[model samples]
Target: MSRIGKRPVELPSGVSASMSGQTIEVKGPKGTQTFTATDDVTIAIDDSSVTVSPRGKSKRARQQWGMTRTIVANLVHGVQNTFKKELEIQGVGYRAQVQGNVLKLNLGLSHDVEFPIPEGITITAAKPTELTVEGHDLQQVGQVASNIRDWRRPEPYKGKGIRYKGEYIFQKEGKKK
Candidate 1:
């Protein structure tokens, strides 16, 4: 009944998927990633595609069907290409730069925030205000970007802070005298 689960994940050229019981391992040019689904869903690998199906008609099984399928799709895509998240710094004297294994951020606070870059991920500052986070794992890339943005969320008053690229911050009217 889940439309998303019905669609098989087609492996692209140079990408392959292998299954062992409930665990699935995907290998691609970028890297190899593995995921283990719960007992509610069944995973199978074919010559050029991977499929997920529910074990029964129960609500949990049906819910896991679609969710498992999407997770498998992400695993496949992640092994082939790296995920990236871009961040933009706003406000006067606000900027970011990457030095060695640390990300230095100046958010106009009393002191600069030094964020340690974790392994398996790369953060690049193309410009003082522009930051790009890249990694083969989609989740890690997004989490790191979120952590960076958390340092200084955009304020509604002046929209001054760190924010994801293309994110819109609704500006509020200034205080009336």
Candidate 2:
């Protein structure tokens, strides 16, 4: 049995969830997001709480029970409280700027890198060095953050380049003189 699956997810106010066939739509103050849940998992909402259950007692159903519930719970949280990913730009002249919907990144490369923002995602910079990605969908938020970080990963030598918030990088020692 899945412990998390058995627990009921309490929904916050100002969030609405609807199901149409395999797709589930969630609307909230931030924005609206939708997902296609697996057929084996069933979701129901009752009085500001969402419950997830498996269709049968099969092995696959049991295994997927908790996973499905977690996904649903995240969706509920996403709609109510926006998910954010913070990235820091290191090295001289390395910075990111938001131009309309495009993110122009200068990471010491031959040319400036332009990454187009996807729908339902917002990017904000607290400072010239820090970039924040916010969205309702967990997958989309994570993917965009990873894509930008991949452009210039932190090096062990100097720990320079873009990295996730609180991410650790072990510094390598330089050669002896």
Candidate 3:
């Protein structure tokens, strides 16, 4: 049995949930988000909680049960509060800044990289070397942070690049005679 799937997702006072077919929508003070589950699971919405159950004893159904439950929980939480990701640049001249709908990055590359911020997401530069990505949807916020980290990932030799706040990069020793 899946212990995670057994737990119901509780809706806060300002949050509401509705389901249509395979899709579940959660609305709260921050915003609304929706998730579509596979046919292997059945979703139920109670007065203050949501539950997901497997349709059968098959392996696929069992897999979907836990995943669907987690998705529903994420939707409920995301609608109530905004998700955020932080990044730190650790190079000599590397920096990041948000201008309108685009993020300008200077990662010691030949030229600056201009990344256009997608809808429903906001990127902010608290300092020249610190960036914050925020969105109501957890998936989108994480994706944006990953994409930003992809550019000039931390090097094993010098550990100089953009990285998550607490990420650890293993350093390699320099060549010696």
TM-score winner among the candidates?
3
List, residue by residue over 1-177, the lDDT tens digit for candidate 1: 999999999999999988888999999998899988999999988899989999999999999999999989999889988889999999999999899999999999999999999998999999999999999888889999999999999999999999999999999999898
- Cα lDDT for residue 25, model 3? 87
* Residues 22-79, model 3: lDDT tens digits: 9998899988888889999999999999999999999999999998898888888888
**RMSD for each of the candidates:** 1.0, 1.9, 0.8
| Residue 55 displacement (Å), model 3 | 0.7
Task: Mark the regions of model 3 whose C-alpha exceeds 4 Å error after superposition.
Answer: none
Per-residue lDDT over 1-177 for candidate 2, one digit per residue giving the tens place of the 0 to 100 score? 789999988877798888788677778887777777788888887877878889899988877779878888888888788789999999999999999999999999999999999988899987889999998889889999999999999999999999998999999999999
Per-residue lDDT, model 3, residue 102, is 92
- Those runs of model 1 whose alpha carbons end farther than 4 Å from true positions after fitting are none
The stretch of ten residues in a row with the least summed lDDT in candidate 2 is 22-31
Question: How does residue 158 of candidate 2 score in lDDT?
Answer: 94
Better of 2 and 3 by TM-score: 3
TM-score of each model, in listed order: 0.96, 0.88, 0.97
> lDDT (0-100) at residue 113 of candidate 2?
98
